[model samples]
Target chain A: MTPRVRVPETGYNFAYLDEATKRMIRRALLKAVAIPGYQVPFAAREMPMPYGWGTGGVQVTAAILGRNDVLKVIDQGSDDTTNAVSIRAFFARTAGVAVTTRTRDATVIQTRHRIPEAPLAEGQVLVYQVPIPEPLRFLEPRETETRQLHALAEYGPMHVKLYEDIARHGHIATTYAYPVEVAGRYVMDPSPTPKFDNPKMDDCPALQLFGAGREKRIYAVPPYTRVRSLDFEDHPFRVQHFDRPCALCGAGDVYLDEVLTDDAGGRMFVCSDTDHCEARREAGHRGEGA
Target chain B: MALARGFADPVHDAQGAFRAMLDALARPGLVQALPAALAPPAPLTSELAAIALALADADAPVWLDGPLAEAPEVEEFLRFHTGARLVADPAEAAFALVADPEACPDFSAFAQGSPAYPDRSTTLVLAVRHLAAGEGLAFEGPGIRGRVRLGVAPLPAGFAARWSANHALFPRGIDLLLAAPGRVAGLPRTARLLEA
Candidate 1:
């Protein structure tokens, strides 16, 4: 008698995406990597979740996730947030893959709004959930016009927008979703990550993949690629700095979030990255709250 | 000729190959190993066949070069496994398979996608006798950190000149995947060959 094959309880294909869909996404991913920062259009498939809830990142992770890969998902730098926990559970249930909150242990990380605080190695892949893949979308609005601009290497409008911000506020007021030039060829939006995380992207060892599901676009920044934030010679691009260290772990030089203690007008700033803060605390780091 | 087999476990195997291919392309000049289970016909290396199986599909039309085009069994194997359409014109192909890199056409002969959509161009998978790291051509570009050397034996004549022309077409040119016996290396259009 032949041996019986045990099927998954969910009855869904591995990673919840069919083989053909995975193939199509893989092809688009190759093209996206080939032409760094150039948005490649793909046939976006609807997922069980909503669009704003990182459908694009989920698809990219599903297509690239192998049986041995250790997956990690984060939203706004926190691993235990509702979005992050849901995504982690989704992959664990469907693909039956290992999930970790530690950045170093993860082989594939699906992120929204922020890159991890820890440095990524060469073998790791970073998938960003991008809401807008085009830097010129808000400026040009017309797809045809933006395509022409990108083809001609016309980035004057982007600079003008920054210049306008400088004219009004005496400095560039734009913070998140800063525009960057990839490999000195195409101007791209590095998702909604804050300008504070922009420097981390330059010469990053990990391969960075960006996906925008509603827009049906995918782009990439290959490992060690040049990603320069837009700035003028006199007024250079700068990252946000904190006046004090994290109240929870006493960590410095990391993005922080403000937390209100009570109605007694007391507030404390803590590390936005939960894993980083916890690791630091375990290593004997202490703060006022700790 | 007996029909060959594809991946033993199609889903996981293809995923593994795709990750390797992704790493190979993302880090240009780096050699990545493909799954060793595919038994393709002659003139098609296991690495190349693995890439085709992982990427090519009914929507992706493939163009086979002289050596591969002449082999009827190769076509049957690819069709049976990947179901990719075979096209004669290089410009119409989404992916091109080349067994003889020495006689392969210039990069201009293939589809250099328009400025609007550069990703629409063809990706060439060339089967070479040797792919390794030595005192070969140095590459510098997006994926490369400073510089890296890659030695691909039996490359086409005037390869530097041809690559220069191809690289000149920023965001609009053909990418290359050089497959040796068990490993493959990528040469995206962005990677520039530093003259010796």
Candidate 2:
């Protein structure tokens, strides 16, 4: 047999979650898929690691990863980012799965902040880290009350909050982490990505899963889940940007991460989604000292 | 140095830990072993840490008091693994883990539920040597539907009276887990304790 070939005890598919855990997770996954955007409360387990720092994604990957899956983990949309690298290293040791940097090459991608620039294909999974699963949580303090609000489909407070923002700041000053109503089902927190990424959530083909370790909540968006940004009709929803091309890739269509290089306030904006930008660069691309 | 990228997770990933915890809580005064165990402190066994770790994360602000309060190892362990926030006051905490309940902060100091919504109450993790099992507290209430005797080791000073006050608060009071080395007995705020 080849060096990589293994037996049952040592061969735990990609991630090391047991079959029972995978079965339980699979049941939850079905519900999430059926519900679209509702935050389904789950019993998040303790990994070798603690909560917060990717327990949610870890569990998801553990349950979903099969023997031949290629796993890619990214933080802030970059594979090189510290947290992303750490998670990658963790899976390499525990799950023994092949890791990839290119978005298209991997079957599953776990991401924080920026989403992939390249459109994800069907069958590819995208997981997100959710700080707070309840979009109405900031407005409502109690879980029971929030559950009632969801049951009633009462979203007056969210509209009021967005309207108030528009009333105060010109053009909806909220940058990232904008809220979206999924498929008219449940209002979901699209992780903490700047509102700029909000537009990317609409009508996606790949599966989107969100996990909140601390809050004990998890939710999902199946392919084609209609994600409407929570905004007033008068003000409408807005994406944040300078309307400029990427400094590094000279790509005008991509989301840029505005970076401050010095104390004198010289600013440079690079593509926030590195995978897309790098792919573009590899195809014989150049930019303005970007 | 562990990096924390709370990337997206499947819906069920978060549910596994929660279901186990809820099961543990529902069975009040029963022990539940966690899927993932960890190195814990003297008072905190692997089981306690596992429960705490599963429930407590960065989103869930945690408060510690008494012996385990602010211990660097514990704090570091939580931060590294879960990215759970450590709060100074008991009132802000979602889960309050105490080494010794007797020397712990006042139960009233913690966040109790308001009349409008009683589930806003905090869940307390009280570590004791042994729970006086099978005989002390005459547990009565919604889940129990009748009286069941529960024995606990000597509680912290005035614990019974304080818990009585907690019970008096009903859904407004804090939930509790009287934990020991490897086992724990859960008591949600809804449970009422009568003399066995």
Candidate 3:
């Protein structure tokens, strides 16, 4: 193992960013945390990587990362996914920090979507890569309009859109990128994570930071902060359910992704959270596939 | 000799300070301790020094008020270490250091930021005599679960009313970090000061 020192072995200044840049991001992060669910605009620097591909989360992680931290990166719930693998490798090379796929082992976890099934501890920091931080962007295209709306707390349009979804479909058809109200004040877009991962955000133990590099936005949900998915009495918010348990790990309660086995209708359910699945399997969890 | 020096371990110390400030600001009314306590010049505690080192950089302008401003060593230490430019006008400062809250300027005197960019507002790092929970003020907002009582002694008179008006500004208002010796507490614009 590389010595957990300030200087990275890769010759990059700690975490691949300069001290000034880190301080700037850290200041924004502090503000972001203070005003939970409010998107704080930051001077998003031009990182080595592109904007959409976890740059925001990477910047956030870089700013907060210490020499002793164990880092983890997951893309769409899978640690081995292409995006996840690259991000994990990037940090390993630049930060020279210990990298882990296990949720329990990681002190800082940067994820694209799907919160880990294993509950996060108090000190852990969860950095989320957000493509669009604005929850009202789709409804109100103009940034000025959205800013005003947020200031006035006029989230009636958001409710109207969801209400319309119910009117069009039998229920609120919005599944991914579901809007949630943080601290009963600011309506926040909890990234594009499956609505299944939405409930995990409520009163969570770990500090949650959302970063959008292209959007130059940073927001946070501090530990134990109240976060409620936007919904009404008539049309309550519900997570997606699978009839069958995970075919590999037998996780019935965990979020599952349905994968087609063949060209035919043959398919199988698997835990969306790969770390959770692997841990359960190692612990003697069994399923039909086993 | 310079009264206060920079962190012994720049990388590690700054990281630790950043994390502590992050935790403190994230959870308002909760007093988080600084990792390393260094005695700065008069009025400025080690906690505030640690914060300024962690947050301020060459790109940002910081304002010092009262005795903290009068102390040349504090300015020299910050300039030499963090490379932060000290500004005279509070409105131009990205960060403001206040040794005495009672002698501090009105909350509106600092940059409240524009409607488009709320993050542009100044963050006040004030030296306080007391930073604990008791009977002073009740805080309820994003960070606070139900309501958390915070007591900060020697706060300027009519601070509650001032804070209420500041809170009314919402997205465009100054955030505060109250530093007392090794402990620090934050009061964001969102935190509502409930009336007694």
Candidate 4:
């Protein structure tokens, strides 16, 4: 195990970004929390990293980060992924805060494309990196019209899109970045998280924040807020199903990733949440692969 | 009057206060404790002072009501600490400090924001006598799991009716932070105040 890093007295401001920037982001965050699911426009600062690489999530995390917070970063549910490791190390050097891989130990989790499998408690915060904050941007393609649609609660077009999917694909084919109605008011884009994670957001105890760097938008779903996925009466919303348990952890009803082993197409389905799998393995849960 | 000291450690302390405020707002009806060391002027509790120090800045204008507005020390303390622009009109404020909740302005008096941008509305930081857990008013909405009971003393008159109207605005309405001596509770526009 690595030694815990201490917060340095010199170098950058507490969290790398200056106090003014943090204040700006903090004000925006307050507004975001006030109106759940409503996209609040903010002045996105240019971080050290490039766009499309979790800058928005980094900003949000930096704004809320404190010396005592146990920070965790995950990319596609894996703590060792390049994105996650870089962010974790970035904060470690910049803020000098303690970093953890355990889901339960973390007070703030900055995630890209997945929520941790463990249930978050009341005080924990989940920040998501959003590439596109607007759920209707691709459909309407007009910022003015989309804002108007959100104002009027005009989500019929979203249902129609789902209906069209059912007509062609025999099911609602929105696999990722699935749209959800927050508090029955605003139609929000829940980042690129798989539809399987949608249900986990409803009535969740943890505060959920979404930030889109390139889009310059920030939104939130407060703890215990009702987050309902868009669906039809005949074609109800459903998550992707797996026929087998995780090859490594023997965990069922969890999102899995398929890894090819042999040249002739031999593959094994494993849990996408790496920490969850490793924890289960440590707890003596064995599977065929183990 | 001498200017009171702000957060001992500006960055970390503000971060802690912001987290407390965030948690309070995220979990409506749940009381979160603020940094207690802050000693602002009378009528301005430490919780509200910490919130103003953490969230209110030059970009965000603040409005005070009743005793808070009358007390020059309170205004000076806020301006000296947070550097927030104090405004006269409540509608123009991004944050409103209500020292006297009983005589505070109605929800409609503050900025309700427009249909296009509801987040632009004002957030009220009301100083209440106390916050307790009891068979008080029932609240159900976002941030609330099923239902939660909150007891706020000396609320504005016709609070239920005013809250109902504020809630009816849906995406456009004011949010509130009830500040007690050491704790604060949030009442976002999404939370509905059930009548007795």
Using all chains and alpha carbons, the TM-scores for the candidates as numbered come to: 0.97, 0.57, 0.92, 0.96
lDDT of 3 at B14: 93
Report the number of the highest-TM-score candidate. Answer: 1
Error of 2 at B39 (Å): 43
lDDT of 1 by residue, A55-136 (tens): 8899999999988888888999989888998888888878888888889989999999999889999989999998888899
lDDT of 2 by residue, A72-134 (tens): 888887788777877777776666667788899888798877788788875577888776778
Q: Report the Cα lDDT for candidate 1.
A: 0.90
Model 3 stretches with alpha carbons more than 4 Å out: A1-7, A263-265, B1-4, B37-39, B133-137, B194-196
Worst 10 residues of 4 chain B by lDDT: B128-137
- lDDT against the true structure, each candidate: 0.90, 0.67, 0.86, 0.89
Please give the range of 10 consecutive residues that has the lowest summed lDDT in model 1 chain A.
A1-10
- Cα displacement (angstroms), candidate 3, residue A270, comes to 0.6
Ten contiguous residues with the weakest lDDT in model 3 chain A: A1-10
Candidate maximizing lDDT = 1
CAPRI accuracy category, model 4: medium
DockQ top scorer: 1
| Residue-wise C-alpha lDDT for candidate 3, range A1-290, written one tens digit per residue | 22333345656787888888888899889878867788988889888778899889999999998878899889989998889988887778787888888899899999997799999987799999999999999999999899989877899999999999998998999999999999877899999999998999998989999999999999999888889999999888999988889999898898888889999899888998998999999999997876
Native RMSD of candidate 2 (Å) = 16.2
C-alpha lDDT (0 to 100) for residue A214 of candidate 4: 87
DockQ comparison, 2 vs 4, better candidate? 4
Better of 1 and 4 by lDDT: 1
